[model samples]
Target: MKGIVFLGERRLALVEVNDPTPGDGEVVVEIKASGMCGSDLHPYRALQDLSRPPESRVIGGHEPSGIVAAVGRGVPRHVALVGDRVMVHHYHGCTVCRHCRTGWPQLCEPITRTTYSANAHGAHAPYMKVSADTLVPLHDSLSFEAGAAIACGTGTAWGGLERLQPRGDETIAVFGQGPVGLSATLLASTRGSRVIAIDLDDDRLAMARQFGADETINAREANVAEVLRELTGGQGVEMVVETSGSPQAAAAGLQAIAVWGKVCMVGIGGKVTVDTQAMLDRQITVMTSYTMSTVAQKSCADFVVSRNLDLDRLFTHRWRLDQAEDAYRVFDAQVSGKGAFIF
Candidate 1:
């Protein structure tokens, strides 16, 4: 089989590798579509959070949708039969942990899970092996690309919305117009909430408007708090999802919410210096969101189908497996919208 490997220092290469054979309680999937995400940039830059050294050469895809080609020993029949389409939960954790028991394998208690493109073999190849429990059925109606997204971008957005539980009566502010941010906008709007989107890029801002943002703010040009305050009619938006790790956006998201409002942080990293006094006085709620739990992933897929969301519009670029290098270069530049590698 052939797969993509991160050679460190912003380098990626498609290399030949042994075909995956599932172990006990595992399944091997013939990948049909795999997504390139912001998190993949970490390994590309040699950040080393989860990726192993150059010698081991871990594969570099986390979100994938594919057909079941083989089931390992002890694999359950109810999960999927041969030829069934499915999405694998990117996080592979030790099942014994309390977190894993709740279907949040990404938050592995002692951190024993094998993360894609880091410690374990990822899906940017012809075949990938995953534990049976991580499998989530992909409805026959949804495209493989959409199924792939459910494990990462879409799933992360759903996780934030599930936790925040935005109501139609409230206004939502989503910071950052990345894939996760766009998903938040689309989902909140579909739920009938008035949404305000914040981002520096005009292209992303435009995309946000199409996704149902009532107003768009370019943080580079205006004070987000002021604009948000103005848009909400002096009463700040009740719910805010900050997907931009920028300290400025993070601080503004908290400050622009109404008293007792909730702020959900879905960005991966960076620090925000909070106003201790203001936070205490406002009776605010702030949640630091991680990746979606396994339950959340399934729920997101169901919701997407039920609502008939047009997420296919968000994906702007698609490359073949041979074009791995070009794919990351464009995605790393962040000039283009969401991109994927299609089989």
Candidate 2:
């Protein structure tokens, strides 16, 4: 099996390794497509800082899609059978936790959940071992690349938008034009909500229009809050989805919405400073979220298929497993859009 391992200085290598075998209640998947997530860079950036290498090597991909190669004893046949196409939910929780009991195992209390690329082996390899419980069925109509995207970017956006519940009568300002933000723009528009997409790059903003943004604002060119204010007739939009994770954008997005508006933050970045007095005066509702659960993962795939969304457009770059290093290099440099490694 061929896999990627990070060796500091933002470098990675393709190495030959033994194939993974399924553990009890687990499955070994032959990975077909794996998404290169923005969040994957966090570990790579800090791996060298540790006194000693944490694991054999750092493997950083989380969004995984594949065909089941083998299933372990006690695994549910109906859920993950050999040769079945599926996406693996990156988060693996302690099944007995309260949060896991609620179907959102990813948010287990006391944080006993283990995720890909952090503590466990990730899907950047040709084969990955995952819990059968984390498998989500991939419809024949959806491509492997799209299934991989659902593992993270698309799933995160879908879950956040579903929580915000954008309506036709409402207007939403999606603060970012990256994969997650673009997904938000497309979903919000398909739901009939007027969408205003914001970004610092002209190219991303242009792509946002392709995703169904009614208005585009380059944060570098103009005041984001001011532009959004004018677009909404001074009352401001009813909703704001901040996927940039920029501290300034975070604060501006929350303050740009109409009184009592809803704001959902999906991006994980610098700290954001908020005004308590202003928040109280406006009675704002702010929510911070991450990836969806395994159940929600299935629902998100269905949501994309039901809307007939072009998840393909989000994947602007694709490479083979051997090209892993170059893929992450450009992605980390912010020179690429949603990317994937096809086996």
Candidate 3:
């Protein structure tokens, strides 16, 4: 089997590797499609420190969709079939911990293991293994590309919106035009919130409009906070989804949030400086959201099944496993609109 290995320092290589066999409570999946997430770029760019040395290369992807090939001993046969198409949670929690019991595995107790990017080998290869607890069955109608996205990008948006709890009548400002940002805009609009999308790229802004943004702001040309303020009649937005991950964008989002409003930080940007005094004075609530829970992932999957989300539109480009290097280059340059690797 061939997999993409990250050798650190912005280095990625496609190399042949041994296929994985499932262990107890785990299953081996035949890779179908893997989506490149914005968060994946952090490690690709060396923004996050590697937990291990460079010599111990790790498999590079997490957002994968595949068909169940085999189940390990002691795994329940009813959980999945040999031919079932599914998506993995990408991260599993220690079922014994308080957080896991309460349904937040991403904050697993002890926090030693993570799917794909950490201790476990991720899905950047021909085959990968995952715990049955993290696997979700995909409907026949959903594409592998769509299923791949459910692991992170779409799930993150769903988690963020769940935290913010945007109402039908309230307005939401999504400050970023990347895949995750666009996913938030689309989901917010579907929930009947008026979505305002802010981004520097015209292409992404146009896509945001297509996804249901009531208005789009070209942050490079105009003042984002002022535009949002004017759009909200000076009261500011009822809720702000900060997906730009930019320090300035965070500050602007804080400025554009209505008093007592909620701000959900979903983007992975540089270190930001916030005006704590102003936030306290305005009585605003700021929260951070990460990966979705199994329950939340189920909800998101249901939403996709019910709403028939336009996953095809979100899949702007596709590459084969052999094209992994080129794919990273395009993603690093932010050239491909919404890219994925198809087996």
Candidate 4:
């Protein structure tokens, strides 16, 4: 099998590697489509420290949609077959942990191994192995590419919004126009919440409006808090979904949140200075959500299947496994809205 290996900072090579076999309770998926996430660009930019020894060199992709190629022991035959189309969860937690027992396995007590972009072998190759427990069967109607997007971007958005619990009549502000923020805006609008989408890019703002944002604010143009206040009629937004991972955006999100409002931080950018005093004074509840659990992933898939959301529009470009390096280069440029690799 051929796959892209992350050798070091800004260094990735396409090389031939041995095919991975499924272990007990696991299954091997023939890669069909894999989406490149924003977080995946961190290592390439040297944003994430890579001084430690490499954990796994299988492939550097997490959001994968494929068909089952093989199954390992202890897995039911009906649950997975040789040709079954599926979406894989990139990170599989220790099922024995308290967090896993409560359906928050992303915060597993001991932190189980992950795939591709994380600590585990990923799907940016011809084949990838994943725990059978973490694989979700896609409906016949959903394409492999759409399934790939749902596993990470869409699922993360659903999980973040679930944490915030945005209601129908309340106004919610999403502080980014990336895939996660855009997905959140679409989901929030479907739930009847008025969405204020903020981003530095006017093109992304336009995309946000197409996805159902009631208002769009170019953060680079004006004071974000002031614009948000004006949109909300001076009451401020009821909830703030901070997905830019920018310090300024985080602070603005905090300042623009209504009294006692909930602020969910889903982006994983560098550290930001937050005003603890003002947050405490306003009685604001600050929360952060990580990757989605198996349950949340299934919920997101269900929503896509039932609601018929316009997921196909999210794909701006596609590449093959051999073009993996070019994919990263394009992502680093951030010129295209989004992209994926189809095997």
Candidate 5:
């Protein structure tokens, strides 16, 4: 088998590797779709080498969806059967932990936690082996690519929106129009909130408009705080979801937020200093959301199925596993909607 490996410094390659086999309590999934997430850029653009320390040399993809190819010993048919379509949660931890039992293995207390594409083998290849517990059934109505999106990027956006709890009569300003941010815009708009999408790129702003952003702001052309205030009739939006991970955007969100409004930070990036006095005076709430839990992942899938959201439209590019290098080369530009490796 061959898998994509990150060599760091904006370089990657498809390298040959041993074929995966299910171990005890694990299952091997024949990869159908593997999503490329923005977080992948962190390791891709970093100076540090991710291809070292043997274990860290794992395949590069965390958002995985596929069919069960094989199941290990003691794996019951009820847990997973060959040919069952599934979406992987991508994290494994000691099942005894409170977090793990609650379906948040990413927050497991044990050091034995395994994160696919980070410390364990992932679905960047033809086959990926994961703990059976991480499997979430993919609804028959949804495509594998949709399941892949719900596995991570879309799920992360859903998690953030769940935190913000935007209402139909309120307004929300979503910072950044990347995949996660775009998902937030789509979900928030469907929830009836007047959405104001902010991004540095007009292309993404246009994409946001298609996703139902009531208004768009080009951060580079206009002062985001000023535009947001003006758009909201000088009061500012009731909710802000910052997905750019830009300190400047975060600061601007705070500056332009309405008093008592809520802010949810979804992007993963640099630190942003908050004005404690301002927050205290405004009595607003600020919180950060990670990816969704296994239960939430299922709920997101259900929501997508119910809403008939054209999540497959989120993909602007799709390639075979062998095109990993070129696929990422284009994705790294950060201008495209989303990319995936379709098996």
Candidate 6:
């Protein structure tokens, strides 16, 4: 088998390795779709010290959806079976921990964890091995690519929206038209919120429009806070979801939120300065959401199915495993919609 390995400094290699066999309570999945997330760029572009090689060479992708190919001892039929379609939760932790038992293994209390694509092998190849607990059923109604997106990017958007709780009559300002932010526009619109999609790129903002944004604002041309304030009749939007991770955008979101408005920060980035006095005077409530839990991943899929959402529209590019280099080259530009590897 050949797996993609990031060699740091924006370089990657496809190295040959032996096929995996599941161990006790584990299963091996035949990869059908693996998504390319913005977060992947962190490690991809990180500068490495040549003197100190990485401790381990982990696979490169985290958003995985596939069919069960094999199951090991102690894995029950009720848990998984060969040929079952599934999306991976992507994190493994001690099963006894409260967080793990409740579907948030990433927050395992014991601190014992394995995050696919980071510490353990992931789904960048034809096969991936993982605990049966990480499998979240992918509905037959949704495409494998959709399942892959739900496994991470889309699920993260759902988690952020769950935290934002935008109302039907209110307005939501989503700052970023990337995959996650674009997913939020789609989901929040279905919930009846008037969505104001924000981005520096016109193409992505156009994608957001197709995803159901009520309006689009190119931050490059205008003041985000001013535009949002004018859009809401000087009161500002009712809610904000910041997915760009830009310090300027984060600060602008805080400036553009209505009094008592809730803000959910989803993008991972550098520090941003906040106005403590302004927050206090406006009674603003700000929160942050990481990726979704396993249960929430399932719920996200259910929502997509129930809504009959055109999640497939999110993909602007797709590639075979062998096209890993070309795929990342295009995705690294960061101006396009979602990209994935389809097996």
- Candidate lDDT values, in order: 0.87, 0.84, 0.83, 0.83, 0.91, 0.92
Give the alpha carbon lDDT tens digit for every residue of 71-95 in model 1: 9889879986789899989887899
Tens digit of lDDT per residue, candidate 5, span 42-70?
88888865447433487999999999999
**102: Cα error in model 2, Å:** 2.4
Instruction: Name the candidate, 4 or 6, with the larger TM-score value.
Output: 6
- Give the clashing residue pairs of candidate 3, or none: 116-122
Instruction: Please provide TM-scores, in order, for all candidate models, with all chains considered together.
Output: 0.96, 0.96, 0.95, 0.93, 0.97, 0.98
Error of 3 at 14 (Å): 0.8
Q: Report the C-alpha lDDT of model 6 over 1-343, residue by residue, as the tens digit.
A: 9888887788787888789999999999999999999998887888965764333488889999999999999998999999999999999999898998899899999989899998889888899999999999999999999999999999999999888776677899999999999999999999999999999999999999999999999999999999999999999999999998889899999999999999999998747888899999999999999899988999999999999998999999999888988888888888999999888
* Location of the lowest summed lDDT over 10 successive residues in candidate 1: 47-56
Q: Model 2, residue 25: displacement in angstroms?
A: 0.3
lDDT of 5 at 189: 91
Candidate 1 has a TM-score of 0.96
Cα displacement (angstroms), candidate 4, residue 3, comes to 1.0
Error of 5 at 259 (Å): 1.0
Stretch of 10 with least lDDT, candidate 2: 46-55
Model 4: per-residue Cα lDDT over 1-343, one tens digit each = 8776666566687777678899999899998988888887776666434564333455688898999999999999887888998998777678788877766657788966454456667777889888887788887889888888888987889989989887688899999888888888999999899999999888888889999999999887999998888887887788999887888998898889888888999999747677888888878999998868777888888888789887877788899877777778877775456688887
| Runs of candidate 1 exceeding 4 Å displacement | 47-55
lDDT of 3 by residue, 166-186 (tens): 778998999887878888888
Worst 10 residues of 3 by lDDT: 47-56
* CA displacement after TM-score superposition, residue 312 of candidate 6 (Å): 0.6
